[model samples]
Target: MKLRFGLQARFLVAMALVLLVVLVMLGVLLQRQRLVERESEALSSDVIHQLVDGYLHGQGRELATRLADNLANPLYYSDLDAIGSILRDQKRDDLVQYLMVFDTAGHLVHDGSAEIEGYGQPMGDPLAAAATAAAGPHVQATAQVLEVSAPIRVGSERIGGVRIGLSMAVAHRFEQRNAERLRGRIDELSQRHQGWLALMLLALLAVLVAAAWYVQRLLVRPIRQLAASARRIEAGDYSVQDHGDTRNDELGDLVRAFDRMSESVARHDRDVRRMAYTDALTGLTNRLAFRESLDHRLMLLRGSGRQLALLFADIDDFKRVNDTLGHEAGDEALLQFANRIREAVEKYGGDDALLARFGGDEFVILIQEGDVRASATRLAEVLVAELRRPLDIHERQVFLGTSIGITLFPEDASSATALMKNGDIAMYQAKVAGKNGFRFYSRAMDHAVERRVHMEQELRGAWERGELSVVYQPVCRTSDGRVVGAEALLRWQHPMLGTIAPSVFIDVAEQSGLIEQIGPRVLHAACTEAVRWMQLGEGEKLFVSVNVSPRELRRGDLPEVVAECLRETGLPASSLHLELTETSVISDELQAAALLARLHSTGVKVWLDDFGTGFSGLSHLRRVPVDGVKIDRSFVADLQRDPDDLALTTAIIAMAHSLGITVVAEGVEKESQYNLLAERGCDLVQGYWLSHPVSASEFTHLLARRMR
Candidate 1:
């Protein structure tokens, strides 16, 4: 039957409606939360201000009324003492602790309670302090900030005002009411929203049921028919016809198209079978079908776990086939050679074995046997015997020998790649020993991986012998010819080798797992020196930045180290910056993201060092909090003369500004180079353009000279 709306269209509409409902719910929830927060803040502020104002106005009016009464109708010391006692009884209960009024002369006139009347808590005449329309009530002392001042005006004759302070004991009573009300309202609103959500979901359920029935009838039926036909095709039966297109809908059109596809599929399958199962030129079983057949045989023999020997055979002196008989004749010789290998394997290795052209002029065979060595020796001899056969190619009789490398499986490794690698290594050994022969693999190759271990041991000692030192390159600001920060670089001054370049030792440290020790020490030393200078009154407002490597960042405790160093050295976080290589940020994306997040949390500035050298520059930057980018010396070294470097520097500066990160150009060797960086609007410029690395004392002296 024809349908007005198809199953796919119904599904799309259902999904769209569900998503729209979800978005609306989320928006409504957020709006409600915002409104509640805004209302609570406004109410709390109004209560606090009104509480202070009411108390102050009431106390001021009472003080004035009592003082005028006391003056107009004389009172004795006996009555005054009674009033002081009354104020003491009332101070603790009401928020009004003590009320005092000062005249224009800073002399206290009327005091509320005896506790503060004589002690004098710095209350002067209210008339002396100028009144501003925008001034809000503020506290004079931290412990007494709860107290508030309310100004009172009486015509043009401004008199003294009262100051009343409320203790912090009433916080619970005031906040509990607001919180309870909010929770109740939130719960009620949540329940109503949940009911609305359930209604919407029930409506969606009806749509789902109708759509499921429609799909079962229209789309699923035709697709199910196609799936059955596909299974029949896979089972080598192409007799099924496409009956999916019995109607005029989309599926019916799909079924009509499928009928044409089956014929082409049958033709391609036949061609692929001939090409894949049979060796194209030699007409032997090709490697693809050969491996499949071997796997099936292996499955039957799974419990046996008997010895399986693999032999990797290579053409001996095969270059002669191409050199003596041209490439076309060489192709013919290779096919004939493959035929001979099959015949040999069949004779010595039996029909149960596997024979395949492993790759390029090489072939592999697997055999199951009780005595692996015996089978290996026989297989090798048979291959040598078959390869001795003569090939007649274009009126020439050419003879090619074979070199075979045999390795036993289950004794080596059960994995295919490992067995292949072992066989290939043995084949190389056989060829090296002498061609036209075969050799079995032995287990002595583990000793070959020891040289790398020895190098790591030496690196551990190098850092312990006072070999590590820092080189500071000034990162100067352009608006003025002043230095803002310095990039800390580590250099190793080996006793025997003079000065070693970082490129050489850095990789050694990374491979040797020495970065964990080296990275922290460098950062700590840099921070210590910067702090020492600041304490000595030499370096002020100078930030020292150290580079963090990926290995160290992952393995080392950077957050604790950064915090501890800042605490230990007494250096402010703003004075210490961390420069991370962009490669570190991109290598392990997740760890880089988490590590960068943690580092940023410690309040230290982070710089993407060597910014332009990494792939996914912009994407990685978004995943982390970055304060700046350090343009690598690699790009800046030739910027004065190279147009590409100049353009890149300009673009980097602009990109950094767009992201709100500062950009510092390194390797500015000349004044003109520095000028170019400054002209490009770089935030900082470093390198020899300012000054080379100096000792701590010399740097301090230089700072002193510059100040002079």
Candidate 2:
């Protein structure tokens, strides 16, 4: 069936036709009025120009120029009164708005109108030495005025210029009178057609009334009902109500469909809530649900003097299981692990406990009431013990341990977010102290973390702020006590905190990922300083060793970063040594060897720092491509006092020598330790016993002394 015109379509078409006719009539009337006004304005402007030019010609150019110059002088107020009187007498049709004069030097000498504010100013642009009027009336302040300018001359010499501004009020008055007559004619014409137009509008209005009534019955009533029903549905009122549109039409079908959709939405709502709050893998509460529960619990426990404990539990070495087994096994392990935690919570935490899985192998447990230290500790121990049991995953046994961090509500933190963060920090501490343990949140930890966060922010701008500097500790030849090289130690001088130790900020930088940015800055600064030292005679052959963190080495760009620094500073790579702690390279020997090989390729020396202090032994050391080993300070600090330390240091130096690698002894604080290290065939020794770390300039002076 073909569709008929709706009530809305017919109504809009009738109204649009009427509006178009009305607009056309008004447009024609306006256009005719504009043309009449334009012609009248041009004629009036020409007449005004002739009057002003005749007045200036009668005054004579020399006398006019002199009078204008006097009038323009702001200091001569009496001259302005005289000029204003002369211009006022010359005005015939009350057309002149203002008058101005410019001297031969282009300085504005006179302004005659009270409307003009500035006098005795330079004329930015002078009209040619001729009479001319502007194309149209120019606006000044509020009213439109015409401007005409002519040269003021003495015989043949042009002395100045005179300008007259004519007001457009007279011309505008004539245009208004014509506009009024045209408007009256338009009104009479409109009155003549008013009856017909009204009849047409009345016919349209009758049709609109009829259509509106029909549309109200046929469409609008049902749509309004459906909207009301939708609002009820949105407000979670799912009960089916009578739609009241019983006509056998599409509206009736739509009402029925709407009823069905409300039922479906109600069903989906439950599923959505479950999906939002529950983890799919373990069917346990998710982070969102945990946070909600935590907030509710915190509100209830606030000021009650009652204690609540939040525990953050993490699986130990979960990544190893994922790597060794398959991802499927990892998923299975997480499920089993979550189940164990749930079991433990049931056993020790009682019915008041709320258990949630924070994704992956991490879970959280809340005890509504508990002893701050004692009860929380017992619950954590139970969970750790329960998680230790082997799980049968795909017929293979898998063992796991958990670390728990516990925080009390009123004591540790007041808000849900702070409580959760404190628990997380405590959990990290437990893992750090060794997994399969538990730690309670303490203020000391918060202070340390806060300090870390503050330092991280400060260290980001430290290099740019010039707060970081390199201090050189002299490295000497053990054989003859002659200086060979110096280790560059980084120091931070915080504006507020004074001098901060390297250990504190460096650890923060590594954790906060700022180390990547700070490392290259230190490297460049040290290289630049090293180049300065290398210029000195004794330090020319001396190498500057810069410490590199594991993060920097893992980036795979250390070679490029170091090379760039060397290239920019003109420091030979061979004279710059990159030092890495044994822990940095011992984890992945192959990757470390690749990185060291690249640096080695650049003619830079690589030293395994803190030797024998890390996990790797001499066999692993032989695999790493390094040029030397630095004996850890622990051994050297005790070298003279402890027989075992002395034996260990001697053996390290001997073995390193046998492998064609040099050995540097660090922390030789006492003369005895230094003498003993020298006797042990150590190649280089660096410690306070000889000289402490000094500033760049001071190191330069030390190099000069050694040369002398």
* Candidate achieving the largest TM-score: 2
Tell how far residue 605 is off in model 2, in angstroms: 2.6
Candidate 1: clashing residue pairs, number: 0
Off by over 4 Å in 1: 1-455, 538-540, 588-590
lDDT tens digits, residues 1-708, model 2? 998675456655665666667557656755665565565455545554455445434433434344444444422343556666666555544655556665665566556566545566665543322332322212222246445555554545555556665555754665566566656665676666665656766776676667777877777667677788789878977664756556677878897787677778877877787899999999999999989988987888788888888899999767546644568988989988887788778878867889999988889998865564676788888888888777787775556688889988788889999999999988977876767899998978888667667777888888889998889999999888888889999889999999998877887777677889888877888888878877775334888999998777766788988888888999988998889988667655656778888898889999999998764467766888889999999888876568998888788888888889999988888888878877778899898989999999999899897798
TM-score of each: 0.38, 0.54
Candidate 1: 10-residue stretch with minimal lDDT: 131-140
Name every residue pair that clashes in candidate 1: none
lDDT of 1 by residue, 436-480 (tens): 789887665323223334545656877677887887776788769
> What C-alpha lDDT does candidate 2 achieve relative to the native structure?
0.75
